[model samples]
Target: MLAKHSKNKKISDKAFITSGKAKLAISKYGKENVINATLGVLYNDLEEIYTFDIVDQEYRKLSSQDLYGYASSITGDENFKTSVKKIVLGENIESNFPNIYTDVISTPGGTGAIYNTFKNYIEYGDKVLLPNFMWSSYKLISGEAGGGYDCYSLFDSKNNFNLLSFEKKVLELSEIQKNLVIVINDPCQNPTGYTLTEDEWEKIMDILKRACKKTNIVLLNDIAYRDFDNKALEFKNIFKDIPENLLIIIAFSISKSFCSYGLRVGAQLALSSSHRVIEQFREASAYTCRGIWSNVSRAGMQMLSNIILNKNKYLELKIELDKSIKLLKRRSDIFINESKDIGLKILPYKSGFFITIPFKKGIDSKVSLELEKKNIFALVMEEGIRIAICSIPSHKFKGLASKIKEVLIEIE
Candidate 1:
């Protein structure tokens, strides 16, 4: 007999299936003739998948042992864990976190970080709060952990972070569960490209601090697309002081940042003022790692560690990443400007891979099907059509926004 969770388990995600259709079209009509934007990966103007030269070259140069061997520890190699702390919290640790203790555990990627978080933090049959708009995997991860998930509205009428909604959900869930966990996918949130302002983040922290009096609060900051953010390390200062009952776990990823998606390297960073809390976190996260991936990739960890430890390589990587950011900005600008001209609405966007076109609750699937007939392939969700601007060339963005608008109106 199959386990209860295993019986009805199916891969219900549409992203890959849609991408497969796009791929067949690309083969039949050529990539130049097809507008394929179903996946989250980045592609250059030449229609080639992008892989950072700095990361690629460094990885290729790794010693055979590093490339073939396991990471030295279940958590990670020491250097990687240290560099990860620096990357997640920034170099000014003493100034930012004068009194807090922090811990890092390497995972297979940001996905693994979240998996561990959901597995460890959420109790069975308990519900975890997620944003209304997010990467689909959050729900799957929660389900895998035997926890239910609910979504809070991501934006208000003014199209700002819906803190009112967030607070209501936080309080409502705290009343129901002894331990509360909320996942905030931000800083270039997938499918929306939205980043929370420092003020919004401050308000969120304040809300959590107040909620902590009633129950333990765990805020999982999924920062997978953080390097594409508008500011560098500006959000780190918000962690200066924290309530003892509030646990902030940041999910760090190298997939999008280093163009090392296949390498599967990332870490979870736990920040708390209580030293004992950190020790407990270390044990739990490391134990979860052994059960799941055992250890992360030594070569990928070394690649990032090498880049972070050396100022020259770090600067070099930054320059290249800045170029990609600029390219993404230009692409979004083209689409955003054209969208405005055509009267199409997108959710608030600052930086990152995608732009979401909000539609009526049930029409997103219809709109997406129509778009497919026009040779445009995008990921369709319950609420909107997701345009992967990162995978499309800058020039291709022209007029496509208007075309989407036309399609929307025609269907209506």
Candidate 2:
């Protein structure tokens, strides 16, 4: 017999399923005939998943013990945590936040980091706040933690961050919930690829300060696509001088940045002005890790630490990653320009793996199904069709927007 929480659980990952269908079509019609933009992973010109050579080289250098041995602690290896902080925060953690205490705990991947945060911070039956258009897994993760979710309008009429809607939701939730957990996917958000401006971030911090007066808050900043945005770190300085009642948890992933998607290496970097709070976070998070996955990939963690700590290796990885980012940009540029030429309406995209094409509400599935008839596979969502620019090659992007427009017209 199934437990109460386990009953009635049905999960279907449309992205992977659509990707599978695209693969079948490619096998039948060839890659040139079908456009597979379902899965979000960087693909080379030859349509192969792109990975940094430096990662492979470093991984090969690890000893047998390094590859197979368990991590020293449930939290993860010391070197792994240090390297993650260096790469993500870009400074020595001690000096950078002398007054704010910090801690890092390794997780299976960015997914795990977010899951742990949800499980620990989100009270039973509580709801987390998310963007209206977001990665679909956030809702599933919250549900798994025995919590529900609400959303704030991601964009206003001006196609900018809707601070008014965001503040209203935060304050409203704070009034009811003892702890408010808010997830902000910034500097290249999923589905829409929109980034918040500096002014928006300042205003957001003000909102959090106001909300904190009513209830304790946990801000989960999911920067899974941070490495793709060349200017993402420009706004990192906003983390300083946070309130004691507020805790910021950054979900850092090695999967996207290092092109180690299957390696399952990620970490939770937590910041708080209170020492006791930081300690509690470390202990509770490590305990959760022991209960769930127990430990992450040792080889994956070692490879990342080796690459980030070594200057030459890190430089090489950066150069390779830059080329990948450029390729993604080229692909996205073609799609955006073609969409403009054909009068296809897409969301305001800055930089990221995905570009969302919004249509009439409740017709996203129909639109995507229509596109599937033409052998173009994309993830259907409540908001729109998400074109994974990272999966499609540069040359294949030509005329895609026009074809998608054709599908939209047919659906309507």
lDDT per residue as tens, model 2, 1-412 = 9998899799999998999999999999998999999987888888888988999999999999999999888899999999988887886667767688889999999999999999999999999999999998999999998899999999898888899999999999999999999999988899899998888898999999889999999999999999888887543468777889999999999888998899998999998999999998999999999999999999999999898899999899889988888988888889999899889999999998999998778887788778989999999887689999998888888889999899988887
RMSD of each: 1.1, 1.1
Q: What C-alpha lDDT does candidate 2 achieve relative to the native structure?
A: 0.90
Tens digit of lDDT per residue, candidate 1, span 349-404?
A: 89999999988786876887888888899998888889999899887887798878
Model 2 — TM-score against the truth? 0.98
Q: Give the poorly placed runs of model 2, Cα more than 4 Å off.
A: 234-236
